[model samples]
Target: MAKKKKTPNDKNVMAQNKKARHDYAILDTYEAGMVLTGTEIKSIRARRITLQDGFAQIRNGEAWLMNVHIDEYAEGNRFNHDPLRNRKLLLHKKEIKKLQDAVSDKGITLIPLRIYLKNGVAKVLIGVAKGKHEYDKRETLKRRDQQRQIDRVMKRY
Candidate 1:
């Protein structure tokens, strides 16, 4: 028998860490599968997740996601998973080594950028990032405002 595919909601994004972009300059990104509990997946499907403070780390030849908040399922009773527990990220050995090497540099870190469901499986997009300086943020904001102004003027035509 052939396996069925569940791809209707392809790239269904559940949560995004908007602050991560403002706080860090992303250098590279990798999509990683997550090891989630039953209730945790339920909560995620309901869009009750917050990725604001989440980050990924490579340890013991594995990738781990930390500080992500997935709300507990209301009907989960005693089986509900912890909202802020560290979750294991499924990544290839080579990817884990690459991430480990990337973070070994000064000021470079691994951060979670977004959580999305791809083919019914929960995945996290991790970014290899460097902390942005205060002035870099201001520059980004300035450029954004200028783009908005330009677009506004063009929209008048």
Candidate 2:
């Protein structure tokens, strides 16, 4: 029997915040659903979302995603969604409470790692992260360089 091949729609990643990993020490991760407008959904499906400056906050018992830029759909007219609007994240009450408590601590924050479509629905991967210090950043870079060198040597064999 042959294994089934995965299709693009299987795990369509829309946008990722590459800088998040370099700047923060991720402690825990959670998957949350997003509340998006029609045009926003279209733009996301078209791969026009940017998670570079995105972050999440728990306010009034609700989780809100901020600074994520989902470009307006090109074909959308007056009803086009705002590119930088704050979107609500759908997380369970228990999860939200835990995130809120964690975020209340000093130097800890909630960052969006990536957004992807699962079973035709959009989901955001969020991380409970603590900011990295200068020396930590340098150490990470050094380790990454060493890993690259090891990979190159292995490939040559």
Candidate 3:
């Protein structure tokens, strides 16, 4: 049997924060399991989650996913989870310690890069990123355009 290949567009990926890639220079990434409520999981399975302004933080020896918006499950009655609640991220103690140390550095922060389901479990990919300057953003775009042009030319041959 062939090993399954993974891509950004993998069928398991439910939501992606493309804006996070544009706004931050990601240095490192970690995959973490999410502790979701019943309705939250339902909403996520329906592709009703947003990662636009979502971030992660290491607080008091635990990791927390903040500002991620998972819409309420329509069938849920009064037991619906809050759309903007801070959800717990399940990572090892060593990982949490390392993340805390990395976040302690000036100008470094944690941002959720994407959310994907792995083996029926919801997981989040968080990035340790540094803010890019305006000029840096422009440079990145220019590089991207040049790469596209190169690909186009190569494809013609």
Where model 2 places Cα greater than 4 Å from the true spot, the runs are 1-11, 154-157
Measured over all alpha carbons after superposition, the RMSD of each candidate to the real structure, in angstroms, is 4.8, 4.0, 2.4
Q: Any idea what lDDT model 1 has? A: 0.90
* Candidate 1: tens digits of C-alpha lDDT, residues 1-157: 9999433244498988899999999999998899999999999999999988788888788899999999999988987799999999999888999999999999999998888888789988899999999999999999999999999999999
Decreasing lDDT order of the candidates: 2, 3, 1
Candidate 3's error at 123, in angstroms? 0.3
TM-score of each: 0.90, 0.89, 0.93
List, residue by residue over 49-78, the lDDT tens digit for candidate 3.
Answer: 999989899888999999999999999999
Could you tell me how far off, in angstroms, the CA of residue 69 lies in candidate 3 after the best superposition?
A: 0.7
1 versus 3: better TM-score goes to:
3
Model 2, 1-101: lDDT tens per residue? 99995433434888888899999999999999999999999999999989998899999999999999999899999989889999999999999999999
Clashing pairs in 2: none
Q: How many residue pairs clash in each candidate?
A: 0, 0, 0
